[model samples]
Target: MSKEEQAMKGLWDMFKKRMWLDSFRMKESLMAYNPSEIHCIAYIGEDMDSNVTKLAESFDMTRGAISKLTKKLINKGLIESYQRADNKKEVYFKLTSQGKKIYNIHEDIHREFKDRDQPFFNQVTEEQLDVILDFANKYNTHLDAEIMKLGIKMRSDNL
Candidate 1:
């Protein structure tokens, strides 16, 4: 393979490894809650209109999956569901007192993580940061397109 291909392969491998390690570390930090649950709590805490449909769209998951997660959260006493006065049929989720505690913990962990990286970010020039941001966005967009194509291919093959 060309040097460019070798470099890209190395970067991809390291990126995957880093992501796996990060998930493991986060799992440890989250203790009782899984990453998805933590994410759901955070999202519910941040969004006023958090519902099964919104969660499903935000997380790119099925409504059934979000419902299951919501049920689990409700059982854990981390979240509660209520309907607005104007919409009896429409249910929305909000973090309970316990859920707020977990959300605050998650936020603190994230804030500390960012603070730990502050020195590195401080060292980077604006131009360098812009280039990095641009590259990251392009790479993410490409991956999203590729993932959609792969999903379509898989569905077609199954059919």
Candidate 2:
């Protein structure tokens, strides 16, 4: 293999492993739920007043599962649900005070890790950081477009 190919493979491997480890660490910190569920909680906590249906779609989960999870959160006093002003059938959810506290705890945990790593990254030159940031954004855009196309093709095939 070419040197470039080997470098790309090493980068991909490191990225994948880091993502897995991060997920595991996040879940360990949250204690009660897995990474995906905690992600849903964090997103909902931040979004404020998003409905179960919208969240389910965002997480690619079934409405029933979202409903169940919402109920669990409500029972834990982490979230509250109410009917939307425009539509009685639409239920909106927002984090309770306790939920916000938990969210803050999660945020602090992440900030601690980020701060710890910041000094290490500070050695990277400004030009290098700019190039890396630009390339990351470009790659994300390209990947998103390709994923959307694949999703559409898959849906058409299913039909």
Candidate 3:
């Protein structure tokens, strides 16, 4: 393979492995909540004014799937749905106390994962880090353009 092709394969391999690790870590750490449910809690906690459509769009999920997850969260007392008094038409989601606890824990889990990988990151010099960041930015922009070409509304750049 050419150097460019080799780099592409390496990036793809790392991306898949990273995804697998994240999913495995989340599943192992939180037995009670599925990955989608856990991510929903985090997103709702981060964006206080999250609605079904926003969640669906952000997650690349269908509105019905988001609705089902929201219902489950509500049943578990992890989230509560509310609407502004003036705007009864649009529904929003917020974390309950239990949900907040879960969100906090999730944040900690992220920190822990970062910490776990800190040794490797610490070994990299600032110049090396800068190169990695630049490459990542360029790749992400490339992906965004590809997504635009495909007419896929979900852009990684937006996230």
Candidate 4:
């Protein structure tokens, strides 16, 4: 591979490793709820139209798996299922007060991580930050195409 390719691959690998390490630390701090559970809570809390299919697609998991997680969350008082008048056939989820609490905690964790990385970001010039954002958008577009090739539908709005 060319030097640029090698450097890009190395950076990607290191970024993924750093994410895993952060996830591990989060898992340690939030032992009451598993990572998957916290993720579901966050999703439901953020999305007003969160449903089983949406959650499954977002997480790249089976509907059954999403159902299990939702059930667990429901039982834990973190989320509640609701049926809209126009879409009574399809059930959606919303975070309860307890779920909101969990969501806030999860957000706080993310904020802490971002704050920890703030120094690196602060040192980057505006032009450099713009370049990074452009690269990220292009990379996301590429990955979205690859995912489509595999016949998988993931959320693109967030990207």
lDDT of each: 0.86, 0.77, 0.90, 0.88
Span of ten consecutive residues with least summed lDDT in model 2: 150-159
User: Residue 139 in model 2: shift from native, Å?
Assistant: 3.0
Per-model RMSD to reference: 3.8, 4.2, 3.2, 3.9
Clashing pairs in 3: none
- Global local distance difference test of model 3: 0.90
The best candidate by TM-score is 1
Poorest lDDT segment (10 consecutive residues) of candidate 4: 150-159
Tens-place lDDT digits, model 4, residues 1-159: 999799799988989988897888688777799878998998998899999999988887888889999999999988999999999899999999988987998898888888988998899999988987898899889987998898956643333
TM-score of each: 0.82, 0.73, 0.81, 0.76
Instruction: Give the alpha carbon lDDT tens digit for every residue of 1-159 in model 2.
Output: 999699679879978876776666676777776555566668887786689878877777778888988888888888889886789988998888988877887788788768867897889898988998897898889877987888753221142
- For model 3, the superposed segments whose C-alpha errors exceed 4 Å read 154-159
lDDT of 1 by residue, 16-113 (tens): 87577667667777879888899999999999999998998888777888999999999999999999999899899999999999999889877876
Off by over 4 Å in 2: 60-65, 148-159
State which candidate, 1 or 3, has the greater lDDT.
Answer: 3
Backbone clash pairs for candidate 4 read none
Residue 44 local lDDT, model 4: 90
lDDT of 4 at 19: 87
Across residues 1-159, which tens digit of lDDT does each residue of candidate 3 receive? Answer: 999999989988988987788778777868889877899999999997999999989988788888998999999999999999988999999999999999998998899779878998899999998998999999899988987998768733355
